[model samples]
Target: MRSIRLTRMDWRDPAFAAGLTLFLVIGTPLVPRGQGIEIQLDPLGYTLLIVSGLTLAFRRVAPTAVLAVTSLATIVYYYFAYPGFFQPSAALVSLYTVAALGARWTALVSGAALCAGLLLISFRPAGLPDRQAFDGPLWVGGWFAAVIVAAETARQRKAYLNEVEQRAVDALRTKEEAAKLRATEERLRIARELHDSLTHAISLVNAQINVAAHLFDRDPDRSRTALFAVKDASKQAMGELRSALEVLRHDDEPERPHSLRQLPDLVKASEQQGVAVKVTVSGDSPAVSQHVDLAAYRIVQESLTNAARHSRASTVSVDVRYDYDKVTVRIEDDGEADSSSVVREGVGIRGMRERVAALGGEFEVGPRPTRGFAVKAVLPLGRSEDDNGGTA
Candidate 1:
């Protein structure tokens, strides 16, 4: 029972209570008397008027109950005398309550009741003049119109607030989704870079170690040289792995630029694994943008690494063509099947594809009809300068 009362109290508004109080106080003297030409407040009549005024204090907390009590009091007082200001004042408040509580149908029914009560009071055995007679239909219609307009206004305001809140929630959700997507993409890219750089170096180390093991009994000097190559390859792989991991862990860390200048080092690094690489540049190459240059270098690096690991080819070609509008890099190996017959694409190829797509370039990797696997990349060098500061 207490909980039910608390729930009803929660629905009441302080503003409605205040309005009811003010109306009742100002209209208290309007209580009528018999032969209503003169003002007369008998003790009993004044006490009932005061009770009606006090009812306004709980108007919002119990609007329907307050309205019924006030209406009944007004009918009894006027039935013994004539119409008064308190009756109309209570009716007006009840109409406003109907609008405030969003009870349009209740307001309509109450208005009809008020009209019928007024008509019965004004016209009994004989009808009064136009000034004294009640305009039941007109008063009912006007009260209902005012209540509906007020209720509709309240509904529209509530709807507008709800819409604003929904939009804010949607915007926050969208930002969260975008951030998650970016983090996932970054993780995938870092994984690919690590695989491409470390796998090739580790393969070289393995090959050198095998040679040293076989030659240890025949030629000690050659075996020592092979062991030295294995140590060097292991160190190189560790360095590349650390660098790639550092970039992934700390976004603010500065990265050294890798470009065409690093091609010689890359070629020598692959040679340690016994895979010969030849690089050639053709055409009066257009000046490469930083992004395109970096992309071109990585493509060559990943492709050579794949060839060394998957294709048992002795010779691999790195060809770069710089034209007026675009720069293209091609890495191809001669026909030689490696130990593994099933060709598998590691994260390296996926990273390469993402890189090229981000730069609005094209990447292709597959076996040539005549021979071994090949990787081809074509990037628009002219637009690279414009995309320099842009994000993918």
Candidate 2:
């Protein structure tokens, strides 16, 4: 099947029609024959001139067709030896429209053909004399060249403006895409923080709640203590959750970053779940940036949480070593570990790795040779305080 397309034009624009009407009215008059020349307007020449103007009126609708029709009429006008010194203005108008609106090759070919026909007419034996033979063609060709040059300049200017508009549209689209990506990343970071903060404390609470329920009837006093421990863990989890959510608050709201000083409290909280943890701090512990502080806290939190939840171990040891330009954190559990399963990581381990990696650091987690699981991270301190870290 063939497809048909419809187009609309503003016929209300009277510029072309009005100009054509004025040109026909003014140029159709004849000069009385005199001074070795006989100039008279015949019926055929007047009709041809009217036809050329009518064709020029529709030039914008089909410029190539209009140019061809007007050029043919012009050739006929000169062929019959019409007595007029002025070439048809309609032909020049049609040529200009074609050169400005039509394809480059079509405009060039039409202009050349029209000019060549005019040159032929200029050399007609009974027409312009020998001395003035080259005058008509030179004047007409130069004027045609000027019109073509102006049309080409307009086309180029139009193309440049279109290109600039396209580039602006592309830049806007790119900026929106970048904003969406940043929002997505912020959501992921919030999710990881929520998990890291709540997971370990919830696990501790679950363990304590189970103990309290088991001893509720038989040992009332022990059950009361277990319930109190549950209350403490839940309260701590709530505090950390509120701190993490502060990121979504207004700019004036103060943000709480989990600092290295909180490591002792984290270890004490893990001990409340019946697992013993020994923490050691070595080297001079200097003040760190906010991102590094938060990342380090999350790393230790996930490590101890994993020990409480997965590793059936009695005790875990944490070693923190701070140097002039780096901080290293290592957590090891004296738990029986499956070498095969240890090689495979879960979300907690991945989150720790992502945090360290965002700071251009090194992270490792696996089963130790003897019979335990271990996680170690070496974080560089060369970046500025303004720099931030990422989550899994």
The model with the greatest lDDT is 2
State model 2's lDDT.
0.77
Local distance difference test values of all predictions, in order: 0.71, 0.77
Candidate with top TM-score is 2
Candidates in order, TM-scores: namely 0.69, 0.82
Clashing pairs in 1: none
lDDT of 2 by residue, 248-343 (tens): 774343565577789888888888778899999999866677777778888999999898888887899999999888899999997778565537
Question: Residue 264 in model 2: shift from native, Å?
Answer: 0.4
Per-residue lDDT for 1-392 in model 1, tens only?
A: 00112114433444545565455555555544434443454665555565566666666677777777776766665555533554455556656665556665666667678667867876765445567565643564576567657765875687789899999999999999999998897777677667766776777888888889988999999889889988888897888788877876786644646787689988987787678999999877656777788778888888887787767778899999988878889998984643333456667888788889978999888777677878899988844353565431
Quote the positional error of residue 86 for candidate 1 in Å: 6.0
Residue 309 displacement in candidate 2 (angstroms): 0.9
Worst 10 residues of 1 by lDDT: 1-10
